[model samples]
Target: MSEKDTTNTSIEENVITLQTAQEWAARWRENPLNTVKAHLIPRVDINELLAEKYVVDIRAYIGVDDQGVNKLMLVGVDAAGNDLINASNGDYIYDFTQPCPNTCDVDSPLYTLKP
Candidate 1:
């Protein structure tokens, strides 16, 4: 498929209220095994990914880092369901999240379980 083809390239905004966001986070944290509260990725990296050629969307996958820590790996996708990544070269794919347990914002409600 060509980049000009808008087949599956329609942008859909996934907007959610803060209350819902908090509730979802809280629910995820309810599971004892889900120790990693959140993952932080730089806006610049996301911007770069979105700016890539034929990158109509981004897909995130759950992964584990070299240290056995859970991580999020992101890759750009085209309208034809093709991944915009190179396994051994380039920098489009990303796994640079900072997991919450060690780098969480103490003031954020999403980082804690409500009593």
Candidate 2:
């Protein structure tokens, strides 16, 4: 298979749509990446964030860790929980030296308080 074909085994695996982001946020909301805490999360790819292109290694609903984040051993499962499919980028970790949250855009409510 071509590299592109090998890159994505799932049609929406690398997609970061609004809904996918929401689910990702909820999954990591309790514990976001904190460099001081030595927590490492997935690096947020600019292209993926803007939906311009699907960058390899940056998956849906991933947070960037400025620290050496733990490597993930990804495995895909079917709705019925059948045979497991190892992710294309298995056993990988994404980290950055610095990362910050931006809530300035109306689309993003990183710091928005709800009533």
* CA displacement after TM-score superposition, residue 36 of candidate 1 (Å): 0.7
> Model 1: per-residue lDDT, tens digit, 16-85?
2334334444554444476777877666667767886788898865545435565666778989988776
Writing each residue's lDDT as its tens digit, candidate 2 over 36-73 gives 22222233423222232222333322442224332222
TM-scores of the candidates are 0.60, 0.22
Question: Cα deviation of 8 in candidate 2 (Å)?
Answer: 6.3
